[model samples]
Target: MKRFFRLPALGLAFTLLFSTAAQALTPDQCRDLLQQYYIDDIPQTVLDQETIQQMLEALGDPYTQYFTPEEYKLFTSSMEDTVLVGVGGTFSLTEGGLLTERVFEGSAADKGGLQVGDIVTHADGKPLSGLTLDEAGQLLRGEEGSSITLTYLREGKKHTAKLTRTAFLVPTVYSQLVDGHIGYLDCDTYGVDTLTHFVDDMTAFSGLATSWIVDLRDNPGGDYYASMGTVGCFAGEDALSYLLDNQGKYSAYRTAVESRTMYPALVLTNENSASAAELFASSIRDTGTGILLGERTYGKGVAQSVLDQTTLPDYFPDGDAIKITSYRFYSPGGATNDTVGVIPHLLLDDDLADEAALLLSTPAPAGDTTGYLRVDLEWRWYIDLDQALSPEYQEAFVALLEALPDQVKVWQGTGGADGWTQTSAAALAEAHGLTDYTRRGFTDSADSPYRASIDLLATYGILQGTGDGTFQPETPLTRAQLCALLAQALNCKMPSGESQFTDVDMNAWYGPAVNALASMGLVNGVGGGRFDPDAPVSHEQFVTIMGRLAQRLSMVMDLAWQNRPDTAGDSFVGWSDWAAEEAWLLAEGQTGLLGNSINLLWDLPQDIDPDAVTTREEAAALTCTLLQWVGILPELS
Candidate 1:
């Protein structure tokens, strides 16, 4: 959307002509122009390429380089389009050699006797053996009119011919759906009309998905407008980035107010993602519209511009040009990614590098660090173990355990015991980098206070809404619902046959969960072989069910603390306190042999109303905490 124009007369090629000037302009004039016009132009101190290049060399900036006319043209042409000068032949490799499939009639390849079905073995003196078809083809390409020597086999006879490089286009922007619903747009670079094509593809994708993965991996960079345009797609009228001139003056580039997409976005980057690509990803992340996932990017934070020929100083001519370091770009947060590139929010290992779709599908947790964990029955072990160790030792031990070789599958349990039991599953998950486990859908429930926990539980497939897109978190949780949630959260297997409760329908929605728990002896039938499926679960009843469930999970807590002499005057030590104390306050109370098990479960607020009827929201919060303690759920932050 931005346009640049040069002044007339002054726009004439400096090598051929000049206007009202006795002699050619000096480097000082060129320096002055850059100081006035460059986005982040340098000060008057550095006068010529020798001085500037030396300064840049000291700073270790490889991109600020001198460009001859030929190199400058090639660079500018690439920025305009992916069309490259080559011996225009579409090739396919065969065992014999590089076979020519199709050659444009007037192209250098066809005009040079490079016929279809010809097997090419070498270019110049370089043999084609072990070279990919694409690599061989690249060797045959150079500046237009440049000559290349190719050895080819035709009709079983080998012959060598020299060919000139000609221009042909290569595909750049590619868009498609990945993993059924995720829209994947891989942009190799931003060239002429690339933004137009990208906009078209994005419009097409809007109807296909509510989430997207914009892949900018290995993209070196392109025109300034194109970079701004790419960032504009996801940002509103906010500053996409800023530029700092040599004088310390800052200029901002902002996105158009009307050209923005609200769809949740995730940008894929890598160590090769640089310049414009880094800008796009950084803008997306800084604007609060997206998250970046992958390795750190290539730190090419400076912007470049071609010095107009007429504006060129006497040291250069029309056939020569230089691409100068115009300005140093800054991220939206005003941080420069020059030498140190932008780091991703989620650092992925190689196995997860291509799993962008899956990551995007998982709903991110609220900004709160605790929302990522889940509260479940297995948390007792972490609690007991932490109680036995000093806090500093516990922290160090966990770090050491996390650093152990994954093949060993070792995790420290209560009393520093080593075992292969299920209690060590969480540590194993961490060791193997298997963190993500849930895909929640409650992100749209904006007005709910329990949105974080609800979304987390839903992500893990432990709970879904009561239909109609509502979780009804405030409603009292019923016995059947609670049983179903517990079964799902614990991954309980369905048991055979039926329970003794007459009121429980075998074909009903909650029957399998009830039966599973009943078979495990974790739940009981009311009087007369009846289970009240619709009865609201009281705090005491909920605690009993959880305690029994914990026992089933091999984590048992003793009630002997209730009679502790140190806590004699306490009015009521309900199930909530017992669960909490068993998990965290183990050694403090009058309990004996407190190192039975360790559970790093949810930390309940001090004022938790233990005797109150358990609400669905409270259950979700508790479930999330317990899941975290047992290591079934990962820390969101």
Candidate 2:
């Protein structure tokens, strides 16, 4: 399917029109077709694109949508600032093929004692049966603060209940303290300045002043910018964020201003604080701005820009109504803080907190790896001038990306280091020195073509087959994976040193790799936390990683190759990470790598067989593309 999804400056412009011979489906008709097929299983497959479009025009409403959690996040962030949650009401087609019953559970109807057997004669005084159940339901669902008055027949009597629509803002933030002195700040919402508010609230703690806690108790966020602003306060005058886009470039930033707190801060987060909040808290903690105390955080590193408006296809909806991913953002240190949230330093739970404290106060009970690990973990996180990063190349090597892929077509098929999968696979192989050997895949017994490709890559040793031999491919690649992969891909030679990223756990398998990568300016994680070892990776994510590496290795490797006729002409320029000239390699298209770049989605089909693994055929395809990008392999067929 030749489709184009544009992330317009204002946001996504989904023009699924036939510019050539393709037919134009009016917005209305498109909406109807989707709804019809999605609901009633109606509508023809293909036709004169125009005829298909006209049919779309016949159905007037453009506001309805069927969404999963991920899709809903995109829809609400850019289109409708408010998304729907709890069922407003459910109705079925009557056996008479007319209007049968309307049930509103937990809504005013249910609250007012309405049931499933009831028939609604009118909604806000309008006849019900004439309106499709969806149309009626649409009228019922709306922005919070709007009221809907429904008149229904219950027990043979007509009754009315005026209900107000509210934005179902999911409350995910939880806060509390452990022991004494550790004032915990659990900020889960990037809900428009939630981080800032969290910081502000932290400043308000009037209690004792020893060690403080900032807890991100499974806090899924509301926005990225808000997350950055929140994290900025703690990060101080250090690069706290970066943006990643599809073109293999990133725009990095630091907190130029001063930090708010002088008091030592301890942050508590888990595999839940995502997006902005994750970015904010992770940066400071990683910098050892304070002690990060908790389990690993939920890694959600991709950033999405809502269209000019979030209430999509509704009033004032863009004619090109769709959510297009634009860019990804990250913490100050150069790190792929994607699906991998923050890992903790203390690694303490309520069960062990007291014992750990005594262990700290007293001594280890026996042959204690625990005490040794704790000390090294603290050194990795809290000490400045860490051994992992060379004093000279710290900032230059690590880069926080600018934006996520506005378009994810960063590679040709057949996997390679450029795409997220290859980026991940290659890193794992390199880190463990299994580059010459093949291992198992991410999954087992997959018969699909994609799975075959994954197996091939494993066989070729281009991609490391996991220890278990099954590629849990969909499991988001972790920050540690990216770091390990980058180091391995670049043929990274580890320097025996202290950890640089405050989040790196010295005892962890990826610890040394994390430090080396951080020192080289490859990737980072949220503040006050350790680098999470497992998380899924995204398209834009690896681009930023490559961008950082390209710059660091440029003038040495990638630059001279770019000026060749291969990069400048003969269609080679079309490559996602390709620059116009060799000089533009580090500068990222002369506008500079950190400039206002954007990319959200690409032309790749999402109908991926989830059960499949990455094969060598796929690896070769991707590897060839990346090899070309890194100036290693030539452009392919």
Best of the candidates, TM-score = 1
lDDT of 1 by residue, 1-637 (tens): 0001111111233322212222233445445555654554354345446443344344333554444555555555554534546787666666756777555546788789887678888889788877876577568657898999999999999899898787755434556655455666767677776687567777777766656778777677777667677777767555557776666556777766344356756677777788888778777766656666666677677887666465554556644454567677766655555544665544443124444334334332333322121112111112223221334333333332222221222223222122213324344346444443212355355666767677666644567778766777788999899988887666565665765688988788898888877876667878898889999887556655654543222111222333335553243354455344332322232223655433222233334455667888867876765544322343332
* Model 2 regions lying over 4 Å from their true place: 1-178, 245-249, 254-258, 291-298, 309-322, 339-637
TM-scores of all predicted structures: 0.43, 0.36
Q: Kindly give the number of clashing pairs for every candidate.
A: 27, 115
lDDT of 2 by residue, 349-435 (tens): 422232223222222223322212112222211111121123342221111000001111111112232222112323323443433
Candidate 2 local distance difference test against the native? 0.42
lDDT of 2 at 588: 28
Considering every candidate listed, which one attains the maximal lDDT? 1
lDDT of 1 at 610: 56
User: Cα RMSD (Å) per model?
Assistant: 25.2, 21.9
